[model samples]
Each structure stands twice: as structure tokens, then as C-alpha cells.
Target chain A: MKFSINQKDLYNALNIVRRAVAKNQTLPILTGIFLKLKNNKLTLKSTDLELGIKYDLTVKAESDGAIVLPATQFLNIIRELPNEDVYLELNQDKWQLQIKCINSLFKINGYDPDEFPNLPQVEESAKFELPANKFKEMIKKVRISTSKDETQPALTGALFEVESEKVKMVSTNTYRLSFIEAPLKTSVNEKIAVIIPGTTLQELNNLLEDEGSVEVEVDSNYARFTFAGIEVISRLIEGKFPNYELVIPDESNSNFSADLSQLHGAVKRASLIAKLDANIITLEAANGLMEINSAEGSSGYAHEEVKIDLEGPDQKINIDAGYFIDVLKVLDSEEINIEMIGPLNPLVVNSQKDGDKFIYLIMPVRSQS
Target chain B: MKFSINQKDLYNALNIVRRAVAKNQTLPILTGIFLKLKNNKLTLKSTDLELGIKYDLTVKAESDGAIVLPATQFLNIIRELPNEDVYLELNQDKWQLQIKCINSLFKINGYDPDEFPNLPQVEESAKFELPANKFKEMIKKVRISTSKDETQPALTGALFEVESEKVKMVSTNTYRLSFIEAPLKTSVNEKIAVIIPGTTLQELNNLLEDEGSVEVEVDSNYARFTFAGIEVISRLIEGKFPNYELVIPDESNSNFSADLSQLHGAVKRASLIAKLDANIITLEAANGLMEINSAEGSSGYAHEEVKIDLEGPDQKINIDAGYFIDVLKVLDSEEINIEMIGPLNPLVVNSQKDGDKFIYLIMPVRSQS
Candidate 1:
């Protein structure tokens, strides 16, 4: 391949595709980025067999060809080059790619483009579009609750369900759960549900821009997301997701509201001491005053109080401080609304903004006392 | 002890003294900061046996007492508190400290003050003062050459020497050397030289500010630096420094100058490929231009060119690209001056600013070809 492109454009394209480059050496070619130029369009793609990313940019083409270069080395060299015209050429006989920009020139050994595996495909007939900003917001909240435990493959991903007029995402690790729903208009005639791997959700969240809309497609074995001139294909988890609806509390016996920033700061400070033990903190609410206390450990004790507007009887519960902090970080409301049925039940944090609803649940830890 | 201190002030003081807290658990108390309240002064000190740091701030005291608290835990807690008056009370019976601020309360376990080790002192008779900014600059340049090899204790630190009107610091790891000298008037009649440990140089660099002057004292076993209401005491390395003067080239067969930033950028790009091999790059200077080339390894080849003003015959040498990049990063000059005698001799990089002279020498690596 022979082409001259702007340095910044090439660097940005590399950044998008390099996210899917294989981190392990199980397949050597998978650790490289496939580069192809034809009809003035330069396409770059990378895949680790489970996830793949592809980006394209227009360039001044001298010849149409292809090569697979090491993603890290090529990206580093391009990043350091001055913002000017960058010339690239491939030597098919030796499988080497030559890069030249101003006074710097480099020849990097690469693998044959033919050796690169094709990115997995999803059924385009099932594709639908949603607002990019809303999709990204849902991914951020749901991915946090995805399990790191690999034994249960379904739990390591988020369940994405889309209807003709509504979209919802849910994830749980048995200890905590996140459920988010947004009203989105689409032309799809049937309901679709798939489990997207946690890694794919993270990368999608990073690549999605707030201004555009994202087109998504799903099949039995693969899912695809396209937005902002980038394409991402991820392998769907084959196992069935658990019944998450039964885990979310349907009603609450008591509810309260407090300043979001104040309660966030209080919980973070309490966790400093509680994290030394099991990261467990007890919350007690009564008389318009909410008390948060860390279990006394080898470090010491921490107690914090935040004023709340109560609507029912007093309540108390013990829960993981880290889980509480995670939801608070993602919440952008002025006031945090919390609901609890009793000490043995889950503490539910739910909010609504711009017609979208988000609910987070933290399972209570049985206190020693 | 009972006192109410501003949270910001307490957090800043903790940040300074905690630098000396022991990272290993040889002695539990050494990993804690000793707090003493007396005569309206709140003193905090931490020591790791080899190094110690102390700072003092005035507070509203109701009584006088002392205790030792874990550095990490206390620092973290104080950092998270609001910027308001924080009340602290000591429970002598339990050896615990109760801290209250607004609606937040904490009780941290601490050790008895009597068990904390006292900070080492330096004789005041042998002290001299130097500009804090100048000293920090000298340390930044010289510390980069300090060896990480613990087998040679003296080479792992910088040799600091001060005369009546001149101060110098030198450090080398056999591959490269850094020499910095500045002229400043002092009251000392006798010359002093000591090897300051690498960790001390790092902490001193971090603590020193630009405005004030630093009072320095050197004894046989320890060196003390006091500035900005902070005191740092460090143990001196008990070994003789190598004769670095013998390694620096006294004369050169060819001298050249190049735009500092342009050359820096070129070398950094060329090293991208050189580092894949042995991090060795060859420099060829002639015809008013310099050519840099990386040896062809399993990765590939890299070549870069930089314009220069040259005098005398042409010169070429192979040296570690990393060592060359280090000096280039530290030099704040428009043009970088280089002196070379032959391929077998070291390459000298020296610059003079504000009557202060800085010199760096990079030894050549024998080329296999």
C-alpha cells in the first residue's frame, strides 16, 4: 500500500482501532492492525477474536494494497511525528511497512495482510439506531455492576433489551445490580435481548460521542455497534442471563432524600476506615437525620451524619461502602433518593432525568450484632 | 491533646512529613507520624530510620500532649475533611485520637509518643544557605544520572560539594554523568562534600519552593535541609565517589550545535526503534547536518536527520539513545552544544545559564560491526 495522509488523522484512527488489539500472544497476527487502502479510502481494523474495531479515513492513494503492522509500535511512531503529511508504503516481498514524515523515516516488519482474521459479522437486518449520549450513559451505569467472576460468563456482561419504542440495560453480580431504561424510537418490529461482554461495553462507552446516534445490530452469536465513523463488533455471551426483575425491590416501606454531594462525601470518608475490614457500613435513618457508621476494625471507627427529608418510619441497614460509592459517582442529581423496606432487604437508589429512569440496588450484609 | 486546626493546614503538613514514613514494616511506629502539641505549636514528624521529615504549624490548643498515628490513614482522613476547623482530642487511656469536624467524627488508634524515635540533628556551626530554586534545579539534573544498582552504594547517590563561593553536584552510573555547578557566597570557611542518597534528593526536590532560601548542614553521618517551615534529615552514604573528572573529555576534535527542541524530538523518534534492540543509536556529523540511525534489529530500521552548525572535522559515535534523551529533556536552551574528540571518547553536552555551568557526558558503546 502507498498513501500520504495527515498525521493527526492517522493517529486518531489508530487510537480507535488499537483498543481491540489482542493483549495476549495466542495469535500473532491478532496483535496487529490491518491496514488497507483502495479508492482513496484507508481502512484500519483490529480484532482479538472476541472484540473488533474498524475505522476509515480518506487519503491520497498512489497504489491499492494492504499490510498488518504491530499496533503499539506503529501507533507510538505516528503519535510522535509532527502534524504534517505522513507517507506510508508497503513492501510485499519482505512484509515491511515504511513510514516517512519530514526528517524521520522508519521501516517496520509486519505480517501479511492475508493472515489477518476477518472481523465477526452481525445480522444487519436486525440493526436499529439510538441516541449516542443516552446509550453511553446506560453503559456507564450498567457496566459497573458486571461481575469480574469468569465462571459465570453471563454475569460478566450486561443484558441489553431493545423494543420498538423503548430500550433497557441490566447487569448484576448477585451482591448488587444496575437497571437503566430510556425511551428511544426505532423501526424494529420485534423485541431483541443480548448479553454484551463487559470489555465491549467499556470500549463502546469510550468510543461513543455525545452528539451523534449509534446503530446497533444483534444476532445469536455476535453484536455490532457503529457510530462516529467507527465500527465495533463484539461476540455475545452464549449463556442466559438470570431473572434480574425478581432481584430489584418492587416497593419500599420507607424513603428519604438528601443532598447528593454531602452524602457522597460522607460515604467516601466512612469507607476509609471501613475498607480496612470488609468495607461494610451501617446506615440508620430517623427524625430527619441519617447516621452512617463504619464497623470498628483494627484501624478505628468513623461516624457521619447527613440531614434527610423522611417520608415514613425509621430504618437501618448494613451494606458495602464501595457499592454505595460507585452508584453515587455515576449519579448527577442534586438530591439522592433512597428507599428501603427493612434490614434484610436491599437498599434501592433510583432516579429519573429527562424521561430516563435508573435504579441501583445494594444487597444488605448481615451484621454481626 | 485538645486542639482545633484548619483541615487544609493539617492536610498540607501531613503531606510533607509523610514522605519519610517507612514503607516496610521493620518497626510499626516508624510507619507513623509523631504528633506533639506544646506552647501552641503542633509538630508532626516521620522517620524511616534512614530519612526523616518534620513540620510545625500553630493551632488553637486547649492542652498539650503527644501521640503517634499511622501516616497513610491520618493523611487520607485529613485530606477528605472539609476546609473548616477540625477538633482533635486524645484519649490517653486507650491511646486513641478522636477527630471531629462538622458532622463527621473519627477515632484512630495510635501508638504512645514515648516509643517514637527522635529525628537526628546536624551541628548548626557548619551550616550555609543557598537559593532554593537553584538547588532544586541542580538536584533535578544530577539525580537523573544516579545508579539504580544497589551493589555500589556511592554510585547510587549524587556527590554534593560546596565551597566558600561555589556549589557543585555530580552523579554518574558509568554510562553517563551529570555535573552542575553554581556560584553563591557563603559564610563557611572550610569546604564540605557529602553523598546524598537518591531518595533524599527526590524528597528535597519535591519540598523545595522557588521563593525562599534553604539552609543546609553536612556532618559525617547526616545532612540536614531546612526551608519553608519544613526540615528534612538524611543519612549520608559512607563511601567515596568515583573520580568523575577523569571521564569528562577535556578537549574535542569536532564541536557542533543544533536547535535543542528539534534535536530532542528527532532523537526521541529515532529511539522508538532503537529501544527494541539495545537502545543504541549511531550519530554522524558532517556537511553542516547530523544523521541518526538505529541498528536494524528484529523490528526494523529508523533514520533521522537534524540540521546543525559544525566546526572542525567530522565525527561519529554509537551511544545509548536513552542516556542522550535524558540530558536533552533537562536542558532548557535554544541550542544544544556538543563536543566530541573521537568515536572512542565520550560525547559532551554542556550549557551555561545565569553564570551556572552544566555538563553531561555520555560514554560511547562499541559498535559490533
Candidate 2:
């Protein structure tokens, strides 16, 4: 393959596709980016078998061909090249690619394009589109709660469900859970639900642009997302997601609202000490005031107070400080609404933006004090 | 002890002294920062035994006392606190310090102040002053060549010497060397020479500002630097430095000048491939053009060319690309002057700034090919 492309454009495309390049050396070909030149357009693709990303850009082609170059080396060379025209040519016989830019030349060893695994295909019949910003927002809220434990395969991903005019994403690690729902219209007539790997959600969040729409298609095994000239294919978790609706509380004995920034800062300071122990902090709300305190460890004790608008009775709960801080960081509102049934039950954070709903639940831990 | 100080000022002082806080747990008290409030000045000190830093600030003192608080914990709490008056009170009996700021309160456990080691004193008779920025520049250039090998104690630090009106710092790992000399008037009548530990040079570089002058005092065992209300005391390395002057060639068979930034970029790009092997790259200067090439490894080959103005015969040398890049990164010059005797001799880079002279040498490595 022979092609000449602007250095910046090529570098940007390589960055997008390289996200799915396999980190493991089990399959050497999977660690490479497949480059195909046809019809004056260069298509770059990478896949680790579980996740794949593809990006295409128009280039001036002298001859149409294909090659798979090591993602890291190729990306580094292109990134270092000046922002001018870069010429690339493939030597099919030796499986070597020559890259030339201004006064720099590099000959990089690559694998045959035929050895690269194709990305899993998603059936177009089950396709829908959603606003990129809203989808990214839903992913950001839920992805944090996804479990890192691999033993429970289903919990390592977020459950994505779409019905009529509503889209919802839910994730939980048993101790903390995130549930977010948005109103988005799509052409789907039937309800659909799929569990997407947390890693894929992270990459999607990084790639998604705020000004576009994402076309999503899912089948029994894979889910495909297309947005802003980039395509991402992710394998779906086969196991069933737990029934998260039952865990969400329908009523609370007491509720309070505190300034989000103030509460966030207080919890962060308290955690500096709490993290030295079990990271459990006591949160108390009463008489228009909120108190956050960490149990004294060998290192020290931390106590922070913030003004709150309280309703109903006084409330106190001992929960993981990290969980509370996560929800607070992702929240966009000036005020934060929290509800508690009792110290033994879960502490719930509820937020609303543009008619969308977000609920975060943190299970209380047994206080050491 | 009881005192109130502005959060920003206190944080800044803590930041400076904490640099010397011991990273290891060999001595628990050494990991803490000593705080003493006498009269209206609050002094903070930390030492890792080999290096010590002290900083002082004025505060509204209600009482006078002393304590040694955990460096990291205190720093974190202060960093998170809002910019306001922070009150600190010591619970002398319990060895815990209570810190109150706006709506936050912290009780941090600390060690007895008496257990903290005192910074070594440098005899004031051998003290001299130098402009902070120039000293900082000299440190930056020489520190990079300090060897990481612990077996050679002398090479692990920079040789610092001040004689007459010339101040010089030199360091080398045998393969590469950096020598810097500056002319400045000082009070010292006798010549003084000491090896400053690389880690101490790093801390001094970080703490020195551009405006003031640094008062330096050296004795047989320790060196002291005082500037900008911060005092740093470092234990000197005890060993004879290598004869680096003999390695810097005074005469050359070939000389060349090239754009510093262009050479830097070309070497960096070439190193991307050279590093895959032993990081050796060949540099050829002839016909007003300098060509850099990396030996072909299992991965690839890289070639870069930078325009140059050459004098004398053509020259070619094989050197570690990393060593070449280091001097390029530190030199502040539009055009870099290089002198070489032959391929078997060391390649020297000579630079001058504001009447100060700097020399960097990279010994050639025998080419594998």
C-alpha cells in the first residue's frame, strides 16, 4: 500500500484505532494496527478479540494495498513527525512498511494483514441512535460503580437498556450502585438490554464527542458503536445482569440537601484520614447542618461540617467515604439531595438534570467506633 | 502550642520542608516534620539524615510549643483546607496536634519533637553567595550525568568547587560528563571543593527562586544553602572525583554547529527505534548535513537528518542517543557548537550563556555492526 497523508490527521486516526490494540503478546498480530488503502481512503483497524476500534480518513493513494504495523512504534514515529505530508508504502514481500516525512525515514517491521482477526459484527436489525453527550453522561455515572472483580463476570460491566423513548445504564459492585436514566427517542420498537464491559465504556467516554450522535447496534454477542467517523465494537457479557431495581429504595425516613461543592470538599478532607483505616466515615444530618467525621486511626481523626437544608427527622449513616466522594464528583448540580432509611440501610444520593434522573446508593458499613 | 496562620503561607512552607522528609521507615521520627512556634515565628523542619530542609513563617501565636507531625498527613490536610486562617494547637500530653480551619477540624498523631534529628551545621567561615538562577542552571546541567550506580559513590554526585572568582560543577558516569563554570565575586580567599549528593542538588534546584542570592557554606562533612527564607543542609559525599578535565578535549579535528531544536528533535525521533536495541545511534556530519541513524533491530530502522555547518574534515561517531538527548534538553541556545577529535574520542558540546561556560561530553560507543 502506498499513501500520503497529513501527519496530524494520520496521527489522530492512529490514536483512535490504537485504543483496542491488544496489550498481551498472546497474539502478536492483535497488537498491530491493520491499514488498508482502497479508493483513495485509508481504513485503520485494531482488535484484541474482545474490543475493536476502526477509523477511516481520505488519503492520496498511489497504489491500493494492506499491511498491519506495530501500533506503538507506528504511532510514535507518526506522532514525532512534523505536521506535514507523510508518505507510507508497504513491501508485501518482506512485510515491511517504509514511512517518510520531511527529513526523517523509518522502516518498520509488520505482520501480514490476513493474520489480523476481524472485529465482531453486530446485527443492524437491533440498531438505535442516541445523543452522544447524553450517552457519555450515562456512561460516566455508571462506569465508576462497575466491579473490578473478574470472578463475577456480569458485574464487571454496566447494564445498558433502551425502551421506547428512555435509555438507562446501571452498574454495581454490591457495596455501591449507580443508576442513570435519560429520555432519548430512537427507532427501536422493542426493549433491549445489554451488559457492556467497563473498559469499553471508558474508551467510549474518551472517544465520544459532545456535538454528535452515536449509532449503536447490538446482537447476542457483540455491540457496535459509530460516532464521528469512528467505529467501536465491543463484546457483550453473556451472563445475566442482576435485578438492580429491587435494591433501589422507594421511600426514606429522612432527607437532606447540602451544597455539592462544600460536601465534596468535606468528604475529601475526611477521607485523607479515614483511608488510613477502613475508609468508613460517619455522616450525620440534623437541624440544618451536616457533620462528616472519620473514626480515629493510629494516624489521626478528621471532622468536617457543612450547612444543609434538612427535612423530616435527624439522620446518621456510616458509609465508605470513597463511594460518597465518587457520586459527589460526578454530580453537576449546586445542591446534593441525600436520603436515608436508617444507619443499617443504604445511603442514597438523588440528582436531576434536564429531566434526566441519577440515583447512587452506598451501603453502610458497621462503624468501628 | 497554639498559632493561627494563613492557609496558603503555611502550605507553602510545609511544601518546601517536606522535600527532605525520609521516604523510608528506618527511623519513624525522620518521616515527620518538626514544627516549633517560638515568639511569632513558626519553623518547619524535615530531614532524611542525608538531606534536611527548614522553612519558617510568621503566625499569630497564642502560646509557644513544639511537635513533630507526620509530613504527608499534615501536608494533605493543609492542601485541602480553604484559604483562610488555620489554628493549630498541640495536645502536649497526648502528642496529638489539633488543626482547625473554617469548618474543618483535624487531630493528627505525631512523634515527640525531641526525637527529630537536628540539621548538621556548616561553619560560617567558608560561606559565599551566588546568584540563585545561575546556580540553579549549573545544577540542572551537571545533575543529569550523575551515575545511578551505588558502588561508585563519587560518581553518584556532582563535584562542586569554587576558587578565586570561578565557580564550577562537574559530574560524570565515565561514559558521559557535564562541566559548568561561572565567574562571580565571593568572599572566600581559599579554594573550596565538595561533592554534593545528586538528590540534594535536585531539592536545591526545586527550592531556589530567580530573584534572590543563595548563601552557600561548606565544611568537611556537610554543605548548607540558605535562600528565600528556606534553609537546606546536605551531607557531602566522601570520595575523590574522577579527572574529568582530561576527558574534555581542548583541541579537535572536526567542529560543527547545528540548530539545537532541530538536532534535539532528530535525535529524539531516532532514539525511538534505537532504544529498542541498546540505544546506540550513528551520527555523521559531512557536506553541511548531519545524518542520524539507528542500527536495524528486530523492530525497525530509523534515519534522521539535520542541516549543519561543518568545519574541518567529515566526522562520524556512534554514541548512546539518550546521552546526546540529555544535553540537548538542558542547553539554552539557538545553535549548539560541537567539537570532536575523531570517532575514537569523545564528542563535546560547548555552550556559553551570560558569561558562563558549559561543556557536555558523550563518549563514543563501538558500533555493533
Candidate achieving the largest DockQ = 2
| lDDT for each residue of candidate 2 in B1-369, tens digit (9 for 90 to 100) | 999999999998999999999999999899899999999999999999999998988999999999999999899999999999999999999899999998999999999998888888886548889999989999999999999999999999999999879999999999999999999887779999999999999998899888889999999999999999999999999989988887888899998999999999999999999998999999999999999999988999999999999999999999999999999999888999999888999999999888899999999997656
Q: Please, what are the lDDT tens digits per residue for candidate 1 over residues A235-331? A: 9998899998998888999999999999999999999999988899999999999999998888899999999999888999999999999999999
Residue pairs in candidate 1 whose N, alpha carbon or C atoms collide under 3 angstroms: none
In order, the interface RMSDs are 0.9, 0.6
For model 2, state the Cα shift of residue A10 in Å: 0.9
What is the two-chain DockQ of model 2? 0.92
Q: Score the docking of each candidate (DockQ).
A: 0.86, 0.92
Instruction: Specify the CAPRI tier of model 2.
Output: high
Query: Relative to the true structure, how large is the alpha-carbon lDDT of every model?
Result: 0.94, 0.93
* Residue A190 CA displacement from its true place in model 2, Å: 1.4
TM-score of chain A of each: 0.98, 0.98
